[model samples]
Target chain A: MRKIAISDGDIQVSTRQLPPEGPEPKPITPAAKDWMLFLGFAATVLTMPIWLQPLGAAYPDLLQKFAIFGIFAIGFNILFGLTGYLSFGHAAFLGVGSYAAVWSFKLFTMNVLPAMLLGVLVAGLFALLIGFISLRRAGIYFSILTLAFAQMSYNLAYSVLTPITNGETGLQLRGNDPRYIDRAFGVESVGLPQTNLFGIDMSGYPGFYFCAAVLIVMFLIAMRIFRSPYGLKLRAIKSNQNRMAYTGFNTRPYLLGAFVISGMYAGIAGALLAVTDPLAGAERMQWTASGEVVLMTILGGAGTLIGPFLGATIIKYFENIFSALNEAELASAFSFLPPPLQEFAVTIVNPFVGEGWHLTLGVIFMVIVIFLPGGLVEGFRRIGRLFRGRSGKRTASQAEVQPAE
Target chain B: MDAILLQVLNGLDKGGAYALIALGLTLVFGTLGVVNFAHGALFMLGAFCAVALNEALTWEIVTVDPTRTTAWGTPLEVRQPYLEAQFGDFGAFLVDFSVPLAILVAIPFMLLVGVIMERGLVRFFYKRPHAEQILVTFGLAIVLQEIIKSVFGANPIPQGAPDMVAGSADIGAWFGMAGSIIYPWWRIVYFLFSVLIIGIVFAFLNFTTYGMVVRAGMQDRETVGFLGINIQRRFTIVFGIAAVVAGLAGVMYTPILPPDYHLGMDFLVLSFVVVVVGGMGSLSGAVLAGFLLGILQSFASMTEVKAILPGIDQIIIYLVAVIVLLVRPRGLMGRTGIMET
Candidate 1:
């Protein structure tokens, strides 16, 4: 009984003779998008080692860093991208996690499982304490408070806490470090203890696979959270906390919740770092390191499920691969070009690689922030739209509305 | 008592540098509402300007001396500054005073840099989020630092004060306490210079018609615009002035702390803390808090304090900041409802 009419160059529906509603509009299953995104992310993670070999980033160390920092960025996105609380102190938790892991190794067995669990638990507790104080203020004040706390932590860790943090040398396992679990189990002392999970060595290919598996699990958890009702509430806080408040939502608890979760994620990342290298340094908690995570989250397209990981991978690639491009490597890279052209290219590109990699990163940061505020995710979306627009007979309006799904 | 006096003097001198940087930071924040993470870089550029001027004044003309040879049988190269060759004693004096002379160069350069940065980048970010402003400026700071690093390398380049002021002044002797309370002559000069510059900035802001308009714009930009004033243009000029102030501070500070790529970052965090403690957008508060924190830091660094607290000096400023934030929230002189959200 409904009539669809074209009026004023727009389609209008007249429902005067129709019923009010039609079977609840089929509920618009949100999990479909989440599941699709998760699968895509999983595929990428599983195949990165194989695919990235051509890009000269296939080393175990680089891959491990990618996975570890991916977790850091993902956790950071939860608090920053989703909730809009820009913390300058997440590194404090990361440092704490590392210290906790190393201390676990010193006191107990070299089993990474217990060490990682301790790291997460300690970091979560630390976050709760910090979040309690910092969440009292919102916006810039919140950022400043977090910064102050972090600075205090850094200063203490570098000096007053030297006995525990080992002053600038960082926390490392000594030969005489008490391994209570190993001693009780009647295991003899080796030259140097390495992190192992159920007798599987946490280094090289196996180590990467272990980290990759953990990353997938973490990613799945993040995906679930993104789809959950609580994540929607966090987004609501980001969009407009005042309105959310008027609707009887206590935003502070939710914000605190996000902060703690993110902090724990950083903790896990820190623990994994220790598992890979078995050392924890005070420099890990510096503000610059904190800033690095922010850059990664933003660069990868914060708020998206896979964007943080992508950002982490890209930044790590730059740090590891691009920074390693010596003059010889550059000359080899452009060897196919004519002699003059090759020299010219090397001259032009020389300042932005090797020791000048930071300059390249800075330029990229500025350009991305200025041009692509949504980061690489927005770039991908635009490319997707362009291809779809060319391949299909869809109208511009239809293409615009497609993202609403 | 003399030790206490000496510590007080040290605090006041340190406070002077902190106040100048924080004053500029507060001025920009008050007018433009942008948290300039690159302001420290501007200060670093100023220090480098002094370095550049020194290098320029000391440019050498080397010639092989036919009359002399080294133990290795190489010709002894006699080097004379090109300036000295041209202007004799005047060139030597100029080289000695290069740091002070560089103020002239730094002022115009910093102003231009500030204006270009504002117009080219910050102008677009006016309506954007503060986070974007921070991020963009942070990126700029990194680029600026890296550029300087490539040019200057990673080491701190030392700059010395003129020979006449290199030694400690017996200022206490004037008051019959010379033996106990001596301080560096250059530090006193630096302090006086800071006060003079601060006075000029205050006078400029308080007494002039331009200052009146700027102050009004700071209060209510739309109202000032409605009155037919170009507030945005004025704010750009203020940003330039802020940059100049920071640059001049850097110029003067070269003797106290050597110019380095990371110097700006080290000062920036502390200056931000000063601004917050002074209360955001309150120039007077920034000045007062700068001195207060500076003195407090000096006292915390005392051997006795160290004996008791054991490295409290390193964290005293941050600790005070945290406490101040918790207790006051608006800072020492922060206005109501600004940046509270």
Candidate 2:
């Protein structure tokens, strides 16, 4: 055998030379990869009506919810996923956005553009005020502070601010309301003016496309933020805030910026809700609504770019599809079995569907939090790794072992 | 003077309920380091225990009596409660006092629930982040309330106080007041019951050796564990005790607020505010903050106050919570670095 020269005890020196440098290789750069991701996301969202048809979720109302809540969850992820600040008052902003949009429809014009702008502006201001007070404390304190402010707003909206909010009846488009823009333009309608994008009514497929476009744009912005230096600073804040502070980094402005942006996103979603439905209810500001956004973020994988969107889609799908499954439908579905067995199956499955959809949601949420803390995205990654064969396994094991050294 | 006194009384009654719930919350937070979002569910379960017991006691045996005919020419039905038939007066007494009697059943049932939850779920989450703990417990809360909703339906079930204490009491006479200061008799009973439970818990924690070890564990689990103590077991028992306290509070509160499936959620948010305002891990602080917020809430609801500040009562508890959190970052009696991270 040839004599082997050992360097540093553990290293065996080999007489191998590195490969020679070649001409600059054409590679898929990070920018190109991001562009691919954006295209893929846009394709998925734009074609949802086609793909989601098989799942019975292609209707305008449910599709609109998917887009609206997708935007909400994406915005929430920027704050909760990156900064690790769990604000339980985000629904207040959503409610504010809806109210602003409705008021815009009543006073300005039936066009969605001005309504959305006003909604976002009002929501941003509200977020600035709440975030200023709540960001003073960290951890659970911050969550409670946000929750308190939201509850206060909810209560005020329900009672004291009835004149502005329209109270329990919720703010709705009135036939006689002075639409100055529409009036000045000499555009008069016989019935309640439908919320529109110029001349296109925002109640059907066209509306879905509009919301889809906004969702795609929001997703692109979120993706940009994820890959940007600001996102890296946010991730740093999440990992270790004190260390960042020690490094002379002022994290407050960054946090406030993320918060206001997320609030504006929620506002846009609220405006979209009014664009489709033209109503704003105090119930939208309830803590449960806030919790729903939180659940969507966590269920989709908070830190991941597309996780919240996926989560919102899954939840809204469940809300619409599962809840619509009545006893009669379930009974017929199980009619192929023997009478006794069929009855047993229906009884067993009854509480998890129909009016009991929330139970299933709770169970799924618990299971996800317990087993897959990284949410469905993490589950998908695990499954993908398993299918990638021995080479993938070897790399994963190597990655795991490298940490020890 | 009477109005102020009445408001104060109203505050005390509400405070009793708040203190009871917040006390258990603080205990669990202190010993287990778990933020149980399902504590409110435990209280709701306790109230349902009363409903269940009442339903059981009043379960009627219906028989068609051929001797008597109905208007439609069918045999008349005679219904007698199984308990009343078996135990006579005692069974009737049981039905009448089922709300109070629920305390007996709820104690053991809630203890088992608390222990099961600790061993099966919460213990595994002890090492997780507070956010995860809150999320998991919140999911559990939803699961519990949903199950209750399925069983009880979506409406509030009315539970009655015993006939002996159902009427309003002349408390003004006892206080030597001018105007008749009337209050519900059951409310007085609930207030007393809460004080008794609070006293018992305090005495148990402050007087017993087991309590001493648990308190030690709360302060420094590692040190206590290093001393050859099974701090984990003690913490589990502490959790059971906390559940018992919350359950009893619920059991007694049914007559005041009918036990609905959503009752727990309504209280859950406010109780959290109470806990945070009292401080994260301080028992006395929790109790103090509970009463303080309760009193403030009742006073805010006064017509005079509402006239000055519209919707003050609706948001007073949360307002106090926000103010307290901002002014005293650690809360009234919160120790430094408990849940600061």
Candidate 3:
């Protein structure tokens, strides 16, 4: 949650008439728009390596993390950003999916395809059971119950299902777990033997590409949904639940559908994580972890399609890269400084930079909440409007901020 | 039977904790119309106060009196502390039976904490949306935890029971729990103390004029305001009262779990769940649900549910919450008033 700076306001707005029913939302802008979005995505992807190259050589594994969490946030935004219904229990689905994927890989085969499918299926099932009951209530009650269930799942994984989840050590295979189909690992190509594309050796860069391709496909699918009828129904639900109910639409199915879809997306993200790491732990479903996704969604721009992805990247960047600075690293970076000055920098920052990364994260979250209440995307929009407003152009925010009396 | 009885006592002790935290949560929610996620942190602060007070009382020197040589007709020395000078004499005495005495000190200190917290952080939230309220309080909780961790370090302080209440009681000679339900004296004392606190809080709320006015304000804030009453000030006081309840709960809980910074995070989850089960803003409902869930948790982990599901004990409370929500969305004792309005 972003910190919101508040003060007593003297101004209050009263509307003489309710908003008129607008025409159906423009379904699809055009194919040209789609091409432009694709071009922008391609440009971003291509330019990532310029900044990533230096750190990628040192810790290549961390680069993949930002992408994975970005996918998770994107999936989360589909429901929370669009529907106006916050689900704090979404991480439970992620946990279930991770475990399910890992188990499937162990029991059935290490083929990434089957494991990912199993993860999605299992998470969807869990979501169905929880959603059936949780969706009965709306608003904050809904979020509270979801949070409780996530905690319960985490506790269960940590305590009761010790044999299955293996408690704190978490379910991991040193080598004993069976992997019948994957004779190799992941998706690579012809007889690589250690990596596999559908049983080709794929524990290399190719697998990374495979995941990226899947992300792009998912993104496209999400964009399509945003323009679809189901999406409109969700928007309607967000606008006014009673209006939809009186209009004779069974809102339950829509709510359930949105939930299950979001759960499946989280499942896929978790399954991907499991495939990459081959272990799943209960920590993924903790309340703090759920809160992280909420922060990511808000920080990036919840309602917008691309906001969560950007938010995820920022958080992950801070988590993996920003925290990588150590005393030696700081000293080396500031070698040009005077000896005493360099020493002071190292001593002052050594405690908080590396292991105290969470402290930094907490500070960042607080700052984001207090300042960018709507999030970073909103910040960008505000910036754009400021430039436009100065140039004597009309801006939507200006209209809202200074409504005509 | 012995194990079961002992577990039942354990359940009640835990229930006492839940009740303490829930009572605070209910008061805040009822009066301020905000869900405070940081209630657990306040409880932790109360327990930490015990540790802080205990550390302050140090008797550096003891003087000997040689004139009291009676029993053996020889010179005998009696020592007395000359320096109960600094922090306070009460704090010096508190170091001896720290946990119990801490409870006494924690009430007023916690009241101060309550008033300050309401005035500083929570007052601004009285008008915010529930999500914003949750966010601000959650941030405050994190900030509070960091400050405590910064000052006290992260390790759990080994607070001890008083000498008079040091060991487990011999129940076998007394009653139904004779061979079964022997509890540590300190735990039993804490539980009894909590019952007394709960009674006092209930009495204060029900039998007092201020309590009546507060309840009336909770029922209809606008109406109370229209009658020319200072509803905001009363709401702030209720917030203070809520803080006291949470702090006292923490104060007594010190000997059981020992005070640690992260203790609040562990307890807050279950306490909030208890609050939800009790059906938001209902005092009696919070207490009822706290004890009910505590006992059910104990029973579930007993050989009963384990035989069927193996880990039913871990998720039973949440599973039950789901069932309750499905059957009665308003919860077991939810009010007809609109929540999240």
Q: Which one is best on lDDT?
A: 2
Model 1 residue B75 CA deviation (Å) reads: 3.0
For model 1, the docking class works out as medium
Off by over 4 Å in 1: A1-28, A336-341, A390-405
Per-prediction tally of clashes: 0, 0, 16
lDDT of 3 by residue, A71-128 (tens): 7888888888777788888889999999998787666676678888998999999988
Sorted on TM-score, best first, the list reads 2, 1, 3
Model 1 residue A154 lDDT score: 92
**What are the fnat scores of the candidates, in the order listed?**
0.68, 0.78, 0.37
lDDT of 1 at B195: 89
Could you report the DockQ of all the candidates, in the order they appear?
0.72, 0.79, 0.32
DockQ of 3: 0.32
| CAPRI class of candidate 2 | medium
lDDT of 2 by residue, B234-330 (tens): 9999999999999999999999999998788778788889999889998998888888888888999999999999999999998888888888877
Name the 10 consecutive residues with the lowest summed lDDT in model 2 chain B. Answer: B171-180
Superior by TM-score: candidate 1 or candidate 3: 1
* C-alpha lDDT score of every prediction, in listed order: 0.87, 0.90, 0.75
Worst 10 residues of 1 chain B by lDDT: B171-180
Off by over 4 Å in 3: A1-31, A53-59, A183-195, A198-204, A325-352, A390-405, B1-5, B58-93, B176-178
